[model samples]
Target: MNIHDRPFFAPTRRLALGLTGVLLALTVAGCASGSRKPQPTPLEPVAALVSARQVWTQAIGPVDPLLVPAVHGGAVALANAAGMVTVLEGETGRVRWRAEAGAPMGAGVGFDGRRVALVTRANDLVVLTERGVAWRQRLPSRTFTPPFVAGERVFVLGGDRSVAAFDAQSGARLWSQAPRGTEPLVLQQAGVIGAVGNTLVVGIGGRLVGLDPDDGRVRWEAAVGRSRGANEIERLVDLVGRVGRDGDVLCVRAFQSAVGCVDAASGRTLWAQPADGATGVQADAERVYAVEANGRVMALRRSDGARVWANERLLHRGVSAPLALGRSLAVGDAQGFVHLLSRADGSFLNRLPTDGSAIVEGPVLVGNTLVAVTRNGGVFAWRPE
Candidate 1:
């Protein structure tokens, strides 16, 4: 579900099913007028500036906010909401192994070459290897982000905004932490957890925090976005995923607030630009790309977060987070079309058609293959030829 329909947390009374959802629903209903929305920006003819083709596709059933393709080299592990996890050889769209997690999945498919970690709908952290389900243990709360796998350990960023680490082999709990934040509402989206060298980093509220992976000690914390709204709904500024990483640098998009880059090595805020975007960002060495909440595309210079260019051709099309691909960038729309744009100018290059459903998550790149998953369970792979 999109942000306007995503669930939110109220500190005192957070319901499991119906009411936590109404928090954002109330925001949308309370904020917007009854005026009918105008149509999405019409598509124009595209002159293919680059040669790219969809090479192969696989069906993994429908997906949701969960199911980020956990990519390792050319292999990608993906799961559907129904608990079917499939590992694919990305280069050829070949299935390496498909297994069941034995329950409905809440969030998942965190793969680090060998092991896969998933949070089940029952609040269980399930770890799987090629041999099958390795170990399963219950978690303290719900999790939306996929478990982050690194250094032979699996990290879980919980829906309650806590951080925990688990042993990949025996499912042993190493450390659990509750970051210091008193925000009443949080976005029900993918968890942002990653590693930069020895420091373990996680997105908690509006800050990207570096913690000692061994003992859950806070090394540093950098604020990428700040809360400023009159109410909790307007003040939601948690950093979303589709983050761009170059060595120690992480380029991220703060929900409904700003887009910024953080030097994960030193926990320093390199620069943050005021950007009203809901999705995350993708970056290359020179520039970072983001899709605005209403579908405007932007290219920001990587050095100081300067706006390089803006393109509104896809405005209101429900575009996914961008995937930087060589001289072009790729994004999928709600209509199941992948648009390739010129990296230097944000101009349209070409559009590729899918199964006519929304791309549920961001586009991913594995090896030379550009990958995208749709809401209808279509997994497509494209390659430049």
Candidate 2:
């Protein structure tokens, strides 16, 4: 399933932070590209004096309606609406693997570096290795989001509102627990396993729950602001989970336009601010950057949730989450355009049309190359001139 961008409001106070000189120079030049369609920008071209390029391009599926492809370990893996996992090479858009799951694999695919895993709407955990099916285990219900891969364990959310852990290698049932609420919509990547805190954090409808790394248990829980109305999309909008020391901090953006940051350690509300149409949120040691639903991007202090800089002209609405490339930010929108912005001041940098009709899935930084994925299943790699 694709993430939906929702709107939210922020306090009026402007955030103050030191801006880097090198980043400012890049930001100004990156935004210099005019708002006109043209040939694909050459790889290793000049923008703000720095070189860039679009190195490679490849199409994945049938490219019918266009779907947001997920990036997994040097590959763009797509579980098309037809219910199959298609893996494409990261550097070159070459097909690495394809497997039929029979039903439409609704839950987006996830990878543990070695294997690509998909939990279908039918509650089946289909794991794909290099050769083929490593293992397949049925769960309780349909998985709305990708599973969380931690060490040798993979965490899947069941339709019965429980989180189950399976051995990544052996596909053995490690542990399972029915938490009070559902897990978050975003999937998580594992780092150091069983270090501390919960490994999985999920927000079902309006409540957030944390699960144990060793065994799925109730580490903590918090109630988020819910949306109103009869057809009130009972599910939590889109949640972005980021790793933290104590636990992962989940940013849940609701359709009703509310944003909250919950600490997975104690299941407490760290801080929350009014926000609307927030697409993607990325955090650094200093601040968290977010792309609003209307294509407006803003940065806020990681500590107090204060607004830093707001750039509305970078890209338009229906763009993918703003991706961070060191001091630079890249985003692709509905217009099939990739934009590079300055992370220091949220200034526009370069705008290049990928010459495709699909929504941009990524401005993913693969090594020194910037890879943007189009909805038409095309992958374009850009590099510095």
Candidate 3:
């Protein structure tokens, strides 16, 4: 018998089954009594990373807004849902400049040299050089990754799974690929990184696809996660990973179990090892690290994907992306605790607190200052001393 069809037992299981069954059954039949699931434990506060005097707080927009900031040149550029991109000085909460662009959506902002490029909801590549319109190209479908600018060439992927290359100077399309899927998820930039050589590692349809920087040719392909259930769509959603490349090792979040490492040149699986939770993946010279969604931090060897160490304390249910800052590894959780782990053994080094607030968006690291954007409309910065 199907799991959802099974009779509910305890209140916790009954609530969970009822919710799942309602989605499948489309209506609740007979519930002897309505029962609510036990609420998850309230997240306790982690220690602060900086002293109270060192804290800086600011408001950008509404609560739960998708105003993710992109760090560049000691400044954080935030894009609002209304298609406005605002540049803010990193050290202070002062706004440098703001410009209105396209309709607000969840596209990303990219940087090449001093220019800021935004992918609009209209599927257009808008390039802003020195805060001015450098050029704009109207594509056929929406784009999610801020144009991958490599030198003068900007590589972009559309909702159709077709990768296109355009001249950065002009909006001239150099080449384009055919659409891959009817409802392709390639438009979402899962993970992108320019490798050591002329190789570019991109997550296409939740799978890691390597391409040559010279021309957008598929050099290699590696599946990062295993398929789940029978439906193709359900399996694709579980194949989530933010890929990274250091030298020749391709680092990606395989599953909740481990980070999968493959040879960048040959597309061969080197190894896969255990991690704390399903988190973001990052890499440096020494190790490949993941900050599991449950806020645990883990480090693995880059050569064979072997576990180096892992720390789960001071972490929350949801966590931020891992930052491999050579000697230190940083991650922030929803509970507002940003932990710094030693790259050598994954030992806890410092904790950056969020002043009792929760981090909803980021634990972005630029230099020594780690910025945590909170859910209570506060952006807190911490520099562990």
lDDT of each: 0.79, 0.55, 0.55
Q: Residue 3, candidate 3: how far off, in angstroms? A: 42
Q: Which ten residues in a row have the lowest lDDT in candidate 3?
A: 9-18
Q: Give TM per candidate.
A: 0.91, 0.71, 0.73
TM-score: which is higher, 1 or 3?
A: 1
- The most accurate candidate by lDDT is 1
- Give all candidate RMSDs, comma-separated: 6.0, 12.0, 10.9
Query: 276 in model 1: Cα distance from truth in Å?
Result: 0.8
Better of 2 and 3 by TM-score: 3
Ranking of models by lDDT = 1, 3, 2
Q: Which stretches of candidate 1 lie over 4 Å from their true place?
A: 1-35
Q: Pick the candidate with the highest TM-score.
A: 1
- Cα RMSD for candidate 1? 6.0
lDDT of 2 by residue, 210-308 (tens): 656576666776765555433212222333322222125544443324556665556787776767643445666566677765567787776767898
